[model samples]
Target: MFTLFRKEINGYLSSLVAYITIGVFLLVMGLFLWVFPESSILDYGYATMEGLFNTAPYIFMFMIPALTMRTLSEEQKDGTFELLATRPLTDWQIVWGKYFACLLIVLLALLPTLIYYYAVYKLGATEGNIDTGAVIGSYIGLFLLGGAFVAIGLFASSVTKNQIIAFAIGVFLCFFTFIGFDSLSQLLSFRTIDSFIASLGINEHYQSVSRGVLDTRDLVYFLSFIGAFLVVTKTVLGGRKW
Candidate 1:
């Protein structure tokens, strides 16, 4: 598993895909967080990084799929997937190895954005007017959200050999998982059912976490979501053997 993990990471770094993925994520985020006149800090009239936290998940919904689309899909297309399955590593190991690689790249893309946080911190009228705990919680929420997206993308890739199809499916699944439930909850009239429906989606938990309320249930939700997708991905791969 470790070997597979390293190989996957090395493969990403050895190609332009890693740089391109990171570049795109940072560029899109940077544009909203700093460059764009309207959303930029200069016009926001505040020293908070809320724009980034609010906007990044939307960008990542598409960006993550692009990163993971080729993980298994390209291998299956090139007939390498069959050869890989014959290795000592189990299906879950392989799925996790690729999942971490994609997640790592996305996280690295997020690293540079810390400068924005620093800029916000310093740009504050009082040199520290920002809600430090909220910002920290939001960052943690974003990371978990990214992880969930990566797992979903990997599942999409596992189901198809066509990268474009994988990306489309992944994006659809990610977007639906992120917002579909929330929308459904709004349309329903029952208060209990409404909250339950909303809780099933990513946005509610993300919002909860982003508010600095570190609820264990939210963490469990993310972990369970990731685990469920990975298990499904492994099942998808297993089916190819039969």
Candidate 2:
């Protein structure tokens, strides 16, 4: 598993995918947070990093699929998946190894965003005026959200040998999980049912954690979401034997 993990990371680095992924994420976020006049912090007249926390998930919706689309799909397309399957590693190991590698790249991209937090912290009307707890919670929520997207993308890749197809399907699935459920819930008139349905969506849980509450249910939801997709990916890989 560790070997596969290293190989996956090395493969991404070898092709400049890691650099591109991090660069694109930073570029987009930087434009919205600092460069643009309307959304820029300097124009907001407030020292909050709220824009970043709000915008990042949408950015991640696309960024994660772009990163993970080729993970298994390209290998399958090029017949390398067969070679990987023949290795001593189990399907779970292979899935997890790839999953972690993708997740690690996402975390690396996010690391530089901490500087935004530091800047906001210092630039506030009073030093340390920013809500540190909320910032931390939002960062955690963003990581888990990215992990969920990676798992979904891995599953999408496992189902097809075409990277483009994998990316499209992964993006659709991620979008549905992130917002579709919440949209559906809004159609219901009953408050109880509406809230329950909304709770099933990623946005609800993400918002909960982003508020700095650290609720265990939100954690479980993210873990289970990632686990469910990963299990499906493993099953797909296992079924390739037929």
lDDT of each: 0.92, 0.91
Superpose all Cα atoms of candidate 1 onto the true structure and report the RMSD in Å to 1 decimal.
Answer: 1.1
Model 2, residue pairs in steric clash: none
lDDT of 1: 0.92
Q: Which regions in candidate 2 have their CA more than 4 angstroms from the true location?
A: none
Clashes of 2: 0
Error of 1 at 200 (Å): 0.4
Q: Which tens-of-lDDT digit does each residue in 126-225 have in candidate 2?
A: 8888778998999999999999999999999889888999999999999999999999999999999999999999999999999999999999999999
lDDT string for model 1 (117-184, tens) is 88889988889889999989999999999999999999999998899999999999999999999999
Instruction: Give all candidate RMSDs, comma-separated.
Output: 1.1, 1.1
In order of appearance, the predictions have TM-scores of 0.97, 0.97
